[model samples]
Target: MPRTLAERTAAFPEPFSRVRGLRELSNGVVLLTDWIEEKVFAVDFGKGSATPIGRVGSGPREFRLPGRLVPLPGDSTLLNDVGNARLSVIGPDLAIHRSIPAQRPGAAYSMSPRGVDAAGRFYFEIPPWSQGPAAPKGDSVDIVRWNPRGNAIEGVGRVKGSDRPSWQREGKPRLTPGIPMVMFGSADGWAVLPEGRVLIVRSGDYRIDCLAGGASIGAGPPYAYPQLPVTDADKADAVATFLQDSPMSGRGPNGGLGHSPAASKEEVAAMVKTNEFATHHPYFRAGGVCRPRKASSGWSGRFSAARHRCSMCSTERAGWCAKCRCRWGGGWLGSGGALSTR
Candidate 1:
């Protein structure tokens, strides 16, 4: 089975240039925009292969170099264009709807913008300069929000900005600690949680830091999962099911033993006899092959895990069920698509 995953960038039209900005519009469409090239494009995200749906022209007045693509729940979308400080929206067919407009902020950013919340709100900051001696600097680089319906922009909190957007402010200073390799105006470089919470990922450290004021900051607990023997098809279905189940997880369990739904009937029976999965998850009254033969075309290594992260903590085993008691979980074979796992 494939042990890792990666995102492959698809080639665009000749004049299209590199996709500097990308996001998902509600109708399952993938939006791609280019700042240097000045254009916006859309595609079906669920297709076995990517396909562009539409294209539009958005030049200087619209976006100096649009940085990020944000799709709000409504008919609105936000573009991190230079002049405008907040998001801008485009209609279904391809028309600029409502946007705060990135007016010349007394400063121009060579970099493109990257992210925004589903709420149509986001933030940006100034940076230090290169080719000239300067320290990281900017206005009180802060986070703010915008409401499409109301067409309003409001301040949420401040992110320490520099007097200049030098190598450090860009998280590329020689003295900086770089882990995730986030550059200014990068996507997935900044993210909004499913809960509408904002967390800033330091491009250098890969350490996630919450942006909203009074937010908590800490690394999650070290977790591990078991690996199972299965074909690519079963693994694929399991990934889809798992993702469907956990709406906001970035990475899945670290494939491990018992964690794989590929366990044999006898192995499963023995596991259930010990009440392994049932102990952690109260909902898991039993454990066994909910189905196995049909696992190829319609197969999903199905196992039920007790709700792990909840308000109340129980003695129940959590995660991949390596050693915790009563671990509850589910899985599938590569029945869906092998690429889905990565």
Candidate 2:
């Protein structure tokens, strides 16, 4: 049974400042990545304490701004250190076994490292968003499989075609070039399931897709939740949340970046007035596939409405199950994606 939020349970010695990712290891040990701390910690709920796993320096075993920590099949862990632009593989003993550069010399990183499958493959994208010099010419894929041993990435598949924005509806109004819009559930809502199947929610229509073996095998039914109309207050709240949570929002007190401490009043107000949120309000949910079968209805659970933080359970909230042990990627709130335990 899922514990109620009011239930007094095991709490870490100190609250986490900002959690970037979570992975459950065997023997009930939970691996967590703290963005603010720039390090990984192994928390043993049974013992009610967290032990720091790696250093926060730029050295071999250190991580700068980490992305996600994926617990692999053989008790190894894949860590995405985005600030340092490297992927460090940590062994069971909490040691860095190997580190791979995340970005290639000439290639751009579309999506940051999201997940690693059982086959030792890392999943992300090279979409070529409009803002960069390597912007795509109206063509780019959203999923790629990177093999660490070979030091290469293979295209897995693209997001569903219908998910693309429809500029035609508004006669293609002229907008600023390079302004970025995110994919389904933002960039964090994607996850690679066991057996190498990839699942992503389609933001355009709130549909979930299952891609595997280099093709999409199925898309889940539409969300049961009604799409709420966005209001000025809603927009303001969304923008404020972004400014508060985004790691790259802007310069910090230290003249550096990475989720700066509460922005100054003037800065926050300025950003709210000037910056624009996506016109097509970002739609997200807590969901995932229960199995890797090719049936159109292979997925379970309906998309639920999300507030500031989406903590919906794709399946029953029974801690970690066999299928979602890694949970490498997640949505904005670290809890938006399909959930199933079958």
Instruction: RMSD for all candidates, in order, please.
Output: 18.8, 8.1
- Candidate 2, clashing residue pairs? 188-330, 287-337, 287-338, 287-339, 288-338, 288-339, 314-339, 315-339
Error of 2 at 1 (Å): 18
Residue 229 miss distance in model 2 (angstroms): 4.8
Question: Per-residue lDDT of 87-199 in model 2, one digit per residue for the tens?
Answer: 88888887787777766656655235656677777776665542376433343445778887887768877653222334422336535321132222222235577678877
Q: In candidate 2, what residue range of length 10 has the lowest lDDT sum?
A: 333-342
Per-residue CA lDDT of model 1 for 1-342, tens digit only, reads 112212223322233433445554445455666543445666553453344422322332254334455444453555655323435666665556655545433434432233344454444333334213433234234444545467565554444431223443455435432111111121112334433455543322223455454354543232233323333333333333332222122222232111113435454334333211111111111111111112211111112343343111223433333332222121121122211111
- Backbone clash numbers for all candidates listed: 52, 8
Q: lDDT per prediction? A: 0.36, 0.53
| Off by more than 4 A, model 1 | 1-3, 6-15, 44-67, 83-87, 104-114, 126-189, 194-196, 203-205, 221-342
Question: On a 0 to 1 TM-score scale, where does candidate 2 land against the true structure?
Answer: 0.67
Q: What 10-residue stretch in candidate 1 is worst by lDDT?
A: 283-292
- Cα error of candidate 2 at position 132, Å: 8.2
